[model samples]
Target: MKAIWGQKMAKVPISWMVLLFMCFWAYMADAEYVKYKDSKQPLNVRIKDLMSQMTLEEKIGQMVQIDRQFASAKVMKKYFIGSIFSGGGSAPAQRASAETWINMVNDFQKGSLSTRLGIPMIYGIDAVHGHNTVYKATIFPHYVGLGATRDPTLVKRIGAATALEVRATGISYVFAPCIAVCRDPRWGRCYESYSEDPKIVQAMTEIISGLQEKKSQLVLNTMWAMVEQPKVSMRTTR
Candidate 1:
């Protein structure tokens, strides 16, 4: 009698069982939100709730940022990736439009939203000079050229323009307004610095205010301002 009963149960079709399981899971997900998922809760309460629920693997995944070219929705969904970036060489497919970029971001976002905690991913790119990488973006003068102008107001306006162009392409973060003070003209990357004089670099920081119209991001280098001394004394008995 037991053998006959097992045979009958097995004949019920596996697809039907899978369909029922999926439906039950969907219903449960839609039925309620824990405190962390509730928008009305205080931020601290939500943070504590979310942190308590995160597993070690999930926390690690959140701290890692995969390059966009190497990532896809399946990877994001599986790993719960928290961030992605497009480097200087990475670009969308040929002749890709603003819509294409938006769609790409949205697809990755959907993957993240489907995770257990539904954390969104931050997308980034280098925006040193007016969204330089995006197709047809307005390219502004580099820091060296801008420095020569000696007009903080002009640099500020450039920063504002850069922010708008970057946002239009669905990117929020910018690596811009390099604040390094370069004293030597021969340094290969001195162009990134605004000026050799500390005062000039200080004044040009007005760009920060303009970029802050949306949100200005800065790169902080723990470098000290020092002058190289002359190897030989210049004194000859006067």
Candidate 2:
């Protein structure tokens, strides 16, 4: 009886030793890989750590921005797409509701997050005039019209409202505030421009302050300010 009891006691330690080894291995593995997921770390540190882990393919995917109509969640997951955009007139449905847009974007976002590194995707839309692509969204005046108002304060309010309407659709970026100095009335995109005068275009940039929010920090870095010259040449006064 004593010999049998001693044998059983010997097996107990071996089982416990195996369990301890597994626990230690798991902790070490998690410590090695999860540093980037730690929110307590500085943003630069976290970014560096994550970048260090990414492969060249992953890095390239981070640079490519695809239109939503051409890409799906599966494609985003496979390629690890960094950004998705809805070009003018592109919506999940014809005049999709805000809720429908949110659902569509969220689905794509989930795919991006499911990659090996789990990086979130940034969604962009041509919300130039108050989420115009979405049904029931407030359609603010065009930049040309807003420029006539000469009310930077009112333009700022419009920007703020546009931001909210955009957020309701789960988009984080906008292609707006076209600061183009329309040199000719013949230009097709003139309505998108704030004014032909450089001064008014510069002044309307204040709208950015209102578009960005404290909590969400929607990126306002994608403004399109192009310079177009008409066919007619102007003579310079010497």
Candidate 3:
């Protein structure tokens, strides 16, 4: 009877050990080292924490952008690609709907988020005139025409509208509002310029603010200014 009691007492310790192990495991699982994930932290502190954790490969990956045609979850996961862009005429399928666009972006995002650090990839589009890549999206006049109005407020409204449409397609970046002050008409991209007048070009930068200030303030809006120097070669185009 003493031997049996001894065996039971030994089993009690084993159960206690298992319980203690489970508690330890839970605490470990809940532990978070990602101070960057906390928005309340100062921006500089978050940037420092994230930069400290990144490997050289990860830093390089963050700087590299690839076209959407070459992008997939597997490719993104493997290369840790930072940004994905839809170059001219690139779409998931011909005349893809908003839902299709969202799914495609989300798929790429999943690959990005699955990485060790879970840095999400930024998706960009050459949405200069509007969300022109999307089917049925509004196509606004180029900057040259908008500049003719000499009304920055009107330009701002158009930009806000363009931002709304761009967001509808699940895009996070715009390569737009071609802020170039075209000095020469011969430049191939002269139409992209708001005006030859530097003042008008400066006034039209209101578009940038419009793109960033969404109605709900929900989007992580980013814009790429495609500034142009006078292209001497572009003189041959028109």
lDDT against the true structure, each candidate:
0.74, 0.79, 0.78
Q: Write the per-residue lDDT of candidate 1 for residues 10-62, one digit (tens) a residue.
A: 99999999999999999998877588878899999999999999999899999
Q: Which candidate is the best by lDDT?
A: 2
Error of 1 at 222 (Å): 12
Winning model by TM-score: 2
| Cα lDDT of model 3 by residue, 1-238, tens digit | 9999999888787778999999999888779547998889999999899999999999999989999999999999988899998977899999999999999999999999999999999998888777888888899888788889898898877778888888888887766656666787787888878888777777777776676674612232222233333311111111
For residues 44-69, could you state the per-residue lDDT of candidate 2 as single tens digits? 99999999999999999999999989
Which residue pairs show collisions in model 3?
none
Clashes of each: 0, 0, 0
- Compared with the true structure, model 1 gives a TM-score of 0.73
RMSD of each predicted structure: 12.1, 7.1, 6.2
Q: TM-scores, in order shown?
A: 0.73, 0.80, 0.80
Output the lDDT of residue 56, model 3. 95
TM-score attained by model 3: 0.80
Worst 10 residues of 3 by lDDT: 229-238
lDDT of 1 at 227: 24
**lDDT (0-100) at residue 59 of candidate 1?**
96
Which of the two, 2 or 3, has more lDDT?
A: 2
